[model samples]
Target chain A: MANLTAALTALPAFLMVSLLLLAAVAYLFRDWERTVAIIAGVYTSGLAFWFWRMDLSQPTQMLLGRPIQLVAPLTVGDFTFQVQTLNAPVIALGLAMGAAAFLLAARASQGHTFVPLGLTLLAGYSALFMAAEGPLAPTLLTPLFLIGLSAVSAFILQAGRVGRVAGPLRLLIPPILAFPFILVATWYIDQIALNPQDNQPAQMAALFIAFGYLLLLAPTPLHSAQTSSAETAPPVALTLATLLYQLAVLYMLFRTISAFPFVVQDAPLASWLEWAGLATAVWGGIAAFGAVHAGRLWGYSALHDWGVILMVLATAGARSLPLALFLLGLRTISMFTAAAGLSVLEQQTGGLSAASLRGAASRLPWNSAAFLLGGLGLVGFPLSAGFPGHWAAFQIVAETDWRQAAVVLIASGGAIFSYIRLARILFGPLANRSLLRERPLSAAMAAAILLISVSLALAPQLLDGPVSYILSAFNG
Target chain B: MEQLFAGLDFFATETGVLIIMAVIGLMILTWDWRVALAGLVVVQTGVAAMGVARTGLPAQWAGVQVAVMLIAAAMLAISAVQTPTSRSLRQAGNWPLRTLAVVLIYLAWRTIDVTIPVPGIAPDMAGLFTWLGLAMLLMLGLSDNPLFSVVALLLWFIPAQVAVAGIVPHPSIFALIGGLELLVTLTASYLILVDRLPAAARRPVMTDVVFPDQEPKDWGVTDDAEEVVDALPLPGFVQDMVDSGRAARRSQPPALPAPNSAAPALPLPPGGSENGETISEQTAAKEQG
Candidate 1:
């Protein structure tokens, strides 16, 4: 048991190396089923690792009559990868999400390199969340490196597929643009270390760091990648990539705040985040109304959700942090469920445009229902998985200022209205085309995801464990 | 060789800034991809030279930077060659807008005149960084093509690269930037290549038919070429080609009957004589069909 604990202590490096190796091996296989199976296995192993580590952390759950310590940091030279209390649950959530994506991708047409690139991205994001410091600073150079990896993976997933490269190409922009500000901010930090009394360097560092993270967050104008990719890129792959990347971004933000509170306190970062997030959410809803493409509509709804999450984070208090994290967890579920349905619909309908999907529900009713229900969930409609979290968030925000809450409610109305319109089109009269039959496997997967979404919605307490787990780090 | 090396100092002067500006101008203004690629190579090398002359970065590291830039340029050059439609020599459609953008970039740089004393950089290099940043913005704002956008992204990274080299000069940072530069360039090149390929060529070859006992069948597959192309709307450039193909076929004159050949007339259906078409027309239609 001690040996196992010791091995788990080195889990960061081990997971990174093994996941990368598995990705490479997965690439060699031409069979997508085999490839997806291998990816699922990798994520499953990651989940199992997390479970084991979490079990060990509990004193009551003893191993060999001794309580083993949780996984420790593995440092080599300047690089450090640690499964700290803060990131352990996040890492577990990421792995579980990846596992779920693989399951959904089992019957979806993820591109040829989806498995390999997906696994590689999974490894990169895990490292991003776990990495405390390397070469330059924690979450600065590290996120850029991982973002670079994601851009490449996005390119591979999107390239040679019949679509615009704007989404994948836009992924390249944030890292390149953020690099200088972050690097220079690190320099300023060094200067601050030399002269602690003079707050100028710290101020400059805070402003630069805020700007850099804003770019990384990619709200509003920078959101072209997310919106455009949603319209063009493969649904399942985009969902997994987006959810994982956003999870890392959230973790990075939390860590940066912990390390440098002045960014929020001294600088105008909170206000900026507040306004930007509000704009993003409002724009998302408005855009969703105009989005003729099903995928684009989903993208806008996600942006709206992300905006609300950001608003929650920007609110003044530590409680806002856990609430925001909880909202993100719900977002992961909603997005995955939506993407699952969208993928099958895209495959059966040959496209995601409104014209292509007109009267599609009559043939593939279950998948269509999944798509509609999941999309509605994103808007925080009642009886959806995201309802409880969103309801709590709105109540919290309303406690502070009712106008902000009113604006958010109105924006959510836009998305819900769009979904209602889409539902009409989905359940509209059938055209006189050839019979389009849904595959049994696809229907089964859609049914399963729909069931999970509904079950979670019905029993929101199921999320209590995860919410508390995420909050544990904060409490400590 | 030593004299040539000394002569290279010409790029370290005020004239060097103008020369670099002109190189980027050529990249933005010129329609020929080869010319843009040439400008890309020259600008990257010139930036490295300026870094070495002003910032005091190691000459060997500057050489490494040049090599990496050259490789990126070569990858783009190859992609441009493979995607012939991207290699037009005609003037850009928006050349006037681009020219105005360049002028605005220069004006903005002149107006800003950032004079802050950066820790590891010389005071005079601020103008160069500002111009590069503005030009990069212009390029990114104007470009829709993957090849040009890749060049724009490279421009965006150059100032940062120079700044990092000046500020840190760590071997690890150098390696990291070089590797990322290569990776981004490679990905953009791939995007360019695939963006130009026919839709059928880019379509995924596999499907989600992972059953144990069932024989693989074309379920939900668009097998016909026309159907495949028509299934989903094509991108702008590809759609333009399709439209042109349709137009060319439409404008083609029907083949006149070969001066006096004894060819049999094509048989019409039993109920097809309502229009009263000539036999020669029937034969010509048959040949076209």
Candidate 2:
């Protein structure tokens, strides 16, 4: 038991090494889909089982009877990795989505790059979550994360259609620009930590950190790269990169912002976040509403959801934090389902433009259902998983300011209208009756994903326990 | 000899190096490719010299810095060689905008007060740091070409590193920054190569340039190409229309063609080859006639 606990301390390293090995194997045996699937299945299931045990067990009793500490920090040189209350659920969710993506890719003959790149992304996220706990995390891990993202972008570009350079190049910019800001912030924070009297640099550092994160999130004005990629890149790659990577960045942002209470409590920064979030939400919704490309609609919708989450965080109240985290989790599920479904539809229809998707529902009913259902969930429809989280966030924000509530409602309305527009395009008349049907296995996977989303939506309580655990950790 | 040594040391000072860097940045903004490339090398050498003098690091570290700079320069040179002649010759902008930016930036830099004290750096040096940082940002903001943007990004890190060197003076950080410079340059080179590929092999341009109608004159079609297009044979009614279109075009010129004029050719349906070949023959015949 002690040995197991000790092994757990090196878990990030283990995961990274294993994923890299698996990537090598997958690359070498690109033709062996079953082998890749088996490797991915084993890794994801192991991660799920580990997360389950970590979540269910007491911190002291997590590793058998050895009285192991789940939140024990593992230091390797200058960096630290730990499975804490805040990140356990996030890690679990990331792994689950990764596993789902791997399976979907395997079924769709995209296992070669998807499994390797997806696993690498998961490993990067794991390290990012762990590293984000400390102030120096950005200095040490930001480059590593960016490099990993660059690799994924490169892989996607290579696999995608010719002349599709813009998407990957766009993905590269935020990280490249972010590196220096984070470095400067790290230096400032270190100075402040060393000399408590120095508060002047703290403000500048905080602003840099916020701007760096904003770039990382790629919210509206800076969102072209993500939107371009979403419109052009393969659906599976888009799902993995956008959902998992963005979630990690969000989590990191929360950690960094929370580290500097001075920054969080400052009225100007908080207000800035609020206004930015609202603007991003409204802008994204309107953009999504007008998007001609179905893939880009998914991107814009995801952007809108991120804005909502950001607004919730901007409230900076304890109650809103959990709600924001919950919404983020919901977003992960909805985006994966939406992107996966869109990928399948894109495969069958050869494009995801509004014209291409017109009447697609008649041809690919299950995929269309997944896409619409996912979009509805994302928009916080009554029965969707997003409803409870968004509702709680609105209630919290509304208590403080009604105008913010009005903005939220308007944004949500725009999103709903956009989703409806997409639904109309998807469910219009039968344009191509002779369309090839999706394989039963692929359809089954899509159905299973849709089922999970619907179930989570219908029973939002499923997230309550995890959310509470995370909140308790934050409070502690 | 002592006076000469003292003067050389003066150029290596924080203020002197920053001034030199600013001048190089200006050169980058206004100069042609060959001169700009030379300016970049000078900028790097000045930066390395500052690192040595400011940090009191061993002179070998300066050599390492110069080596990294050479590698970066080599990458830019390769990319410039590979880039199409038109794009390679593409200026950052006209002299007027460049001059306005320079004057504005210089005035702003000279007047602005920097309150946040970067540890170990003198107040004047800190101001220089802030100025160079803003200058790098301006360079990035003004340029759309990937090559110039990457160069701006590479230069952006130097001022910060110089400011920090006097404070922390860590070897690893410098090494990391050096590695990052190399990584960024390599990535930029890759993007240039990718950008220069035949349109059929490249990704679709994703930029939604607002004033596409305001494209630069260098990108304008040559009169010879227009004459060639006008000479292309057309059916009787189409020929009459083409003549009218030519007259209209002469009055109000067309916007620059898409970045890759060859893109439209690649997507022709497989069965349309005969029709395409026949049209090509007719155009050829018309030109010969």
Q: Model 1's CAPRI class?
A: acceptable
- Judging by DockQ against the true structure, name the best candidate: 1
User: Across residues B1-289, which tens digit of lDDT does each residue of candidate 1 receive?
Assistant: 2233245667788898789878887777653466667787788778777877777767777778878888999998888767534332111234455566678777766787654345677666766676667777776665445777778778867777888877776788888888888888888888877765532211222221112112222212111222122223443554566567556654777555577876545433332333554445654565578
Chain B TM (all candidates): 0.64, 0.62
lDDT of 1 by residue, A1-476 (tens): 97655654365766677678877877787366645665665566556465535753543333446443446567766778877767777777777777776766676667777777777777887777777778876767844675577665666458348535767877777767777877777788888889999999889889888988887888887787788789888788888878877777777776787788778766898888888888888898888978768999999999989888888888888679878878887888899889888988888888888888889999988899888888888879999988887898898888878888888889899889889888888889876277477888778878998998998889988877878887665443
Q: Which pairs clash inside model 2?
A: A162-B202, A163-B202, A163-B203, A163-B204, A164-B203
Q: Compared with the true structure, what per-residue lDDT tens digits does model 2 show for residues A1-476?
A: 97655765454555566677877787777678667866786778677667755743454543333344555566655457876666676777778777777766765544356677677777777777666333345433464366446645555543535444556655666776676566666667677778888776677677776666666766667666666777777777777777776666766665666667655543265676687788888787777777767778777777777788878877855677778778877887888788768878988887887777888887788888888777767767787767777777778778878887777677777777877887888888867777787778778888998888888888988977866755554442
> Candidate 1 chain A: worst 10 consecutive residues by lDDT?
A55-64
TM-score top scorer: 1
Task: Looking at model 2, give its docking quality level.
Answer: incorrect
TM-score of every model versus the real structure:
0.83, 0.78
